[model samples]
Target: MEELMRQQQLSNGQKSERQELTCSVLFTNPKFRADKSSTKDEINSIARMVSNAEDLELDRVFRKVSKNDVEETRSLNRSLFEFGHNFEDADGWLKLEQPCKDQLATVLRYMFESHLKTTVQIEINNMYFNCHFIVLQVYSRFFSELDMIPLLVTLPENAVSQKAFMLSYKWMLSDEPVLELAHLVEVYVAATYLRITSLEAHCWKYFDDEECYNEDTACALYVESKDNPAMDVVRNLMLTRIRKFLLTFVATKEFLDLPTSHLIYLLDSDEICVNTEIELFDGWVTIGTRGKRTFGV
Candidate 1:
């Protein structure tokens, strides 16, 4: 009877150990078996609307958004996509689609028509933007930090133009005008700097090699993004295209305007299309002389 009891005790211990192992396995990789709930998927889908790279880059350039703010922003955007025209669900949670758009349009119309009811003055590179604080604040976290009355803010060097800012505002209010190709670069830089995730993503499609291949345009974009470490990827992409079109690039105003160091760096590239040292020297002289004449030096 003692021997039988000992075997039963050993079996019970093994059974407990097996139970522990099973529990550990179940909890080890929760994501692999996470609940297949629609709520979780809904939040995740909006979270992925803006890519990690773009979000991180925006935060690096602009100030970082709080975790709560980030979640709220994503939720708000999801609401817009899921339900247009500012409709609310049974839970009474509001989506800000048409309401914000209508508000913005009214405010802009008022401001432009010289009504001057509730406008804030924002300064960017000697240009003044008299706009409704609420409207501007609604779309950009950068604007939200302003201390209210007639707020003045200055953007960094080579930031957005007045047109780009207005266009971005329009896009935020209503997805209209459809992201004009002519204003893409300025709008992209502005959206990124202002941490406007939607506008940034919208403008991103214009940066692909096929659309941005022109030598002057590519070189100009390359120079503009070179200063910001967050924009290194964009700068490198432009550089690649510039090298691809080296022959045409050498004669362009953009190439002429490059600092001597950059010009020398380009001259060193084996991929440059010049057939001989003489041709290379001629190209160099042409760029330098054109730069001098253009600048009236």
Candidate 2:
């Protein structure tokens, strides 16, 4: 019945000429070629409409409507995706102090990725992050200082035990373009957290070759979940990403036995020299003996 309703709405939506007007400047498809000024005005109008709607759990409630009207659906998607980051200062990350920058790094590496799992894949490709890679570099700088899970300081309160994540939902003014990208960026980062965590939960112990092992025990029931086809596809994709991430740190044997954190520890034992990249990023620290009791301090 829900599918039928969506189809019915789409038919009516096609007949509505008003649906053709659009506010998207990034894509210039046949249906959305409104003039720049007109598009900006329309986006502003929508922003004002939603600015103080203040309905609790608004996105969930809105999803309940299940409209097939394409433009209405899309306009709402764009608005919800752009809500936060509006209040950030003109030079938000650029002008931040070192401590604040450090905090932001923790937020990105751990906090942000854990937040957006609902809408994003666990492993995101370079396609999207390219636009905002600058912020990511900043994230690498400040929070990247630890060899261990900086998770102690970075865990969102909600994530410690609850279903929620700590995310800044600060609403933005109507003008800046990055505001449009903020929520999407949040989604991307949150997905990264889930992907990394999945690796920790499922494959951290085996130091050999996880793929070779997964292949060896291909028929084992514990490795493969239930009989749903869609679920199987998803599981396969996730495993594929996990493999790639592991390859980066995983020596053929090292990857099969331990998780990423343990592996890093194994390689960065006390006698290790300070690599140039580490100094440049200032993301990693060593403690005890050579790395003895040393960190960004």
Candidate 1, 226-278: lDDT as tens digits = 66555656666666566556777666666656655455556665645566646
Q: State how far residue 295 of model 2 sits from its true place (Å).
A: 64
Q: State each model's C-alpha RMSD to the native.
A: 30.1, 34.6
Query: Candidate 1's error at 23, in angstroms?
Result: 99
TM-scores for all candidates: the values are: 0.43, 0.14
Scored against the true structure, residue 97 in model 2 reaches a CA lDDT of 70
Cα lDDT of candidate 1 equals 0.64
Top candidate (lDDT): 1
lDDT of 2 by residue, 145-176 (tens): 43543212333321121121222111111122
